[model samples]
Target: MLASDVCPGEETIAAYVARKLARDERDAFDSHLDTCSACQELVAAVARLAPSQSADPVTSIGAASTITQAAAEALRLPGAQLGRYSVLASLGAGGMGVVYAAYDPELDRKIAVKVLRHARAGDQLRDEARAIAKLAHPNVVAVHDVGRADGDVFIAMEHVDGVTVRDWLRTPHRVPEILHVFEQAGAGLAAAHRAGLVHRDVKPSNIMIGNDGRVRVLDFGLALADLEPGTIVGTPAYMAPEQQRGEAVDPRADQYAFCVALWEAVAGRRPEAGGRRPEPGGRRPDPGEPGTLEGVPDRVRRGLRRGLSARPADRFATMDELLSELFPPVPRSRRWM
Candidate 1:
């Protein structure tokens, strides 16, 4: 049931598929699982073959996370080994899986390893990897590598040592600074759009701010193409009307989410449910419900209002266009030399 017993050309992982072992022995196997990336991936492979394993949670989501934390502590990843990277510490865990700050000996740099929980085919993983690999932009967090480790599919990504856009908004910032940050984020989305990709999820939490003062759009996990209608994807408050209606989403959906994030950043609150968009024929929506528009410029507010329009057609055609409306380039006169 453990990697040690089976790793040396013995019975395969299939032989240990969710096998019941003694409590002490299970704990020991879990310890081995912590360091052996190969074994971890093996577990993931079996999980794919038997999806029911994940459905059996010991308790609620929060309790599961607590148990996961306890398990991690017991393993204590210090000097922990993986395929090609040494795990330094656990950065955080989300619905998908756990992420660790690791050191890549070959690259001689720090990287983030995201281990996805679900089982996806190798071909699918490779295709997604290829697409993400092509998206190389300053504003987009780079995906350095992707491969199966042991049994889990892990993504090696460029680590940005900083806070999320959500947390960043909690700190005080000037209007210009806010606009600048959002512009950079918009650039990332624009890049994705040009590559024929729509970032279905564009909440503030998906945006990362590096300590180097660079704003990057992260997590393309939900950015899949041709999602069937009725696919409920994205955060509710930040979701576009079309998305809520279960219609196929496009770049305009991202525009709507961007507007929501910007609005929250400025107003310090999300747009209420049933809130109407700023459309001429639609019911007039209160632009002041989230409180005074102090420090929010008229141009910025107007752009946000339009982007937040319920109809996708009413919103900005592209992320770049939305940015241009919010920040038109200043004309420069050249002196005759």
Candidate 2:
């Protein structure tokens, strides 16, 4: 290869293609691969030429030798077609799959296409599409289509041009600004609850704040119509007690997570500092006890406390109710007729 074709991390390609890179190193490479076109082409070439008989776990690419499944999926080059969408570039990857920025010729618009990691996840992907498809709210990411291509299941969704709420919170923001973003996200959650679906995962990273000043709730991958008991899912820092215990969960669980995220954003600390899960049958924090949230307004603190209650029953009946508490409505003025 020419010197111009060489990338900084070229040495790791053999280990990466052979699936021998340490977990952290591999993850670092994955992030690097997203933006490094030269590295991507190098990795794809190495995978194609590497021996197939290696004992390492093999992630096939069109009947080729071993490669990390995530790498294989993310290597879909520009101009590659997944169904009718022309892949432009990889957006990112998560536990479930890699998201790509693509163009739909039929609609003549840019879209996000998430290609799942496992073929068996097709059913779950369909489930997520169905859940989000039910809501037409501005605060929710819209799902456009779901289909399979080359044994991979994918969901095409609205391409959001903005930072995640977690990223948005990196800079210091006013209390009102934080609440404004979260209220819109909460509205999306409320809509999902009304549609008989629960977004099992609600964290700052899952919420997006578009450049247009719109807040949207995305990634309903863990959403479910029924809470299957004994199945624990969600980010640990934001999971409610019920979710931690692998017990059946409802919309209130999402309320708990929302409060945790909002509390962290406003107070600069989570109500539960360490992402600790309260033990089953553990004593709920005394509602009257003064906690870490010192400077927060009385009403906002009270609202967050109730939402973070260990027992779901102690939480606001619905996401709408919690939102009202967080951002109460102003009373109308009475004028002389």
Candidate 3:
């Protein structure tokens, strides 16, 4: 009745979708799938994900600079193969997994593929990828497909050409430009919220601003549809007080993270070290106390402070309310109405 109980060497989701199993084996696996919703849903989605559209061209490729060729090769790079895509170059490495720019010859496009570090994490990745693929917002990174190749789980995604918000913050940016990009990032979170999902991780590193001047929120690796209490997950520096306490989290948690990161972008420092690491649950920094706040407009400063409030109820009730405050309506001319 459980996927774990299923004997090893059964047809993988990809193999099942590809009809690579022998008749008897396929029938047995089909019988097993009836009780294994995880594999059943995975195989269904993978089948539905078959190349149905033309590829969107990636104007640019390599954006991240880390993990050298030799290092990547050790991770099975350069000529490494995963499902329908082949590795082209290492994009970056992170806690979730190493990302590689890959070529999907079937789709005839360059896609960024995340290869999970643990062979056992295939189910988790499948759940995460399914949730992300359902989110189709412009400011959200697009998940094209997911598959199991050999002993690895890989997610093929739209390759973004740009720097993370953290790296982008290293440069000088006018307040308007900063808020504009962040608004896009917030929109991505807002969209996820509307879809009943919460981005448990919302630090600057998860946000990307492309060369095309578009801001995208990437990596739903830590996202959850119904985040319950006592689920501590996210960067400590940007976590909401409730999130740090492992209490229930909603979209407001992401709003808190957004403000914290935005304040850092403005002040060039984190508000407060909530904790030394994940689940530290330390005090949050006062947004108004940062010396740099003097240079920031009162309107923006006030909004950030409310968003960084210790209590979720005290913050903007929703992302729409937050955006309304961040970018207030221009006094419409009486004539325009």
Candidate 4:
């Protein structure tokens, strides 16, 4: 008997293929594997051994198209409906869970929902959900509801329709536009820091620019209330040296990431990761200023340099400090409204 014939389980092969191909190009292999019973059995065996913990018992399907094989055998779970809301479509998937765009029939609004894929082996979902719920800020995406359904943990949050700053920067941004983003991001970080939180992940991908010209910081999955050691949960490209080393990090780590992102936007190329900048034509710019950014202004370049300082002490102590220097404290009533 084939693996499918021997192993009888509810987890389907189509879901398995979708999860596996989540990051790679979607192709015929996924479709064929979905219909092959032998392949399905192999997938089931492998899934049992894999470290997957989905919030829903059903498997995740990536941005791949449907094919005969997968379409024929894939099991379709009911769309998630919690309280007065119904999940409409998948937005994206993170390390531990997936985010969805959901409709609330009672309020007649769309909300963002994050459901845990698998409960942590040690920690309860309630604990994590409560921690996240405490965060409330205009700039930070708000957590409205959190709970479990059919053993799957979920969180309903305010949805902001937007594109990530990183995606927006794939094309060049004008100097003013870049500065606008930095200013708003700095303010958001300042608010979170004041509440005794540090956003462990501070990359372009985590910063969003909405169609309404508002900037909102997204994803607090890696955020923590207190600075601590031993959590390795930030994106490698944007992580501070201390974070990568698993050392205790403070708000300065976020400043470092902020500077790195600013540099990428202004400099038009990623700064060398190890810092030092290869002597830059044998003479570094004045202590807190960069020599080049092609088109970025002097004030913005200076700020970027300070944020990317080699030593944490050299960086701004708080996002507020950075924001004050970039944008004065006065409220932009006209622009904001």
lDDT assessment of candidate 2: 0.72
Cα RMSD (angstroms) for every candidate in the order listed? 11.4, 7.6, 15.6, 10.3
Pick the winner on TM-score between candidates 1 and 2. Answer: 2
lDDT for each residue of candidate 3 in 1-337, tens digit (9 for 90 to 100): 2243483232244454444555445545654553453444334333333223123111111111111222323354577788878889776553335678999899789989876543234465556667778889999999898777775567788999988887787789887788788889988888888877787779887899899988999877555222344745455557788886788788999998899888777776666533322223334656566455657778888898788877788999998788788877789668755
Better of 1 and 3 by TM-score: 1
- In lDDT terms, how accurate is model 1? 0.68
Whole-model lDDT values for every prediction: 0.68, 0.72, 0.67, 0.60
Q: How far out, in Å, is residue 99 in model 1?
A: 1.8
User: TM-scores for all candidates?
Assistant: 0.71, 0.73, 0.68, 0.66
**After superposition, which runs of candidate 1 have C-alpha atoms over 4 Å from their true positions?**
1-82, 119-122, 224-231, 273-292, 333-337
List residue ranges in candidate 3 displaced over 4 A.
Answer: 1-74, 117-128, 224-232, 273-282, 289-292, 331-337
Q: What is the per-residue lDDT of model 1 for residues 1-337, given as tens digits with 9 covering 90 to 100? A: 3454444111233333334344334434543543465555444434333344354332221243343344444332757766788889776543345678899999799998876655347576677677787999999999888777766667788999898887787788777887888999999999988987777879888899999989999877665222345746455557787886678888999998898788777667665524444344332355544644577777787887788787888888888999998887879998899
Q: Write the per-residue lDDT of candidate 2 for residues 1-337, one digit (tens) a residue.
A: 2233334343466666565666446645654554465565556555444544345433333232333452554468799999999999976654445678999999999999877544335476566667667678899999888788887667788999999987788899898888889989999999989987788779888899999989999876555222345855556557787786788888999998898888889877655444543445533343336655556677887887788778899889999999898888879999989
Best by lDDT: 2
Clashing pairs in 4: 53-117, 53-118, 54-117, 55-116, 55-117
lDDT of 3 at 35: 43
What is the number of backbone collisions in each predicted candidate, taken in the order shown?
A: 6, 0, 2, 5
Worst 10 residues of 3 by lDDT: 57-66
- Candidate 3, pairs of clashing residues: 230-246, 274-282
Using alpha carbons, what is the TM-score of model 2? 0.73
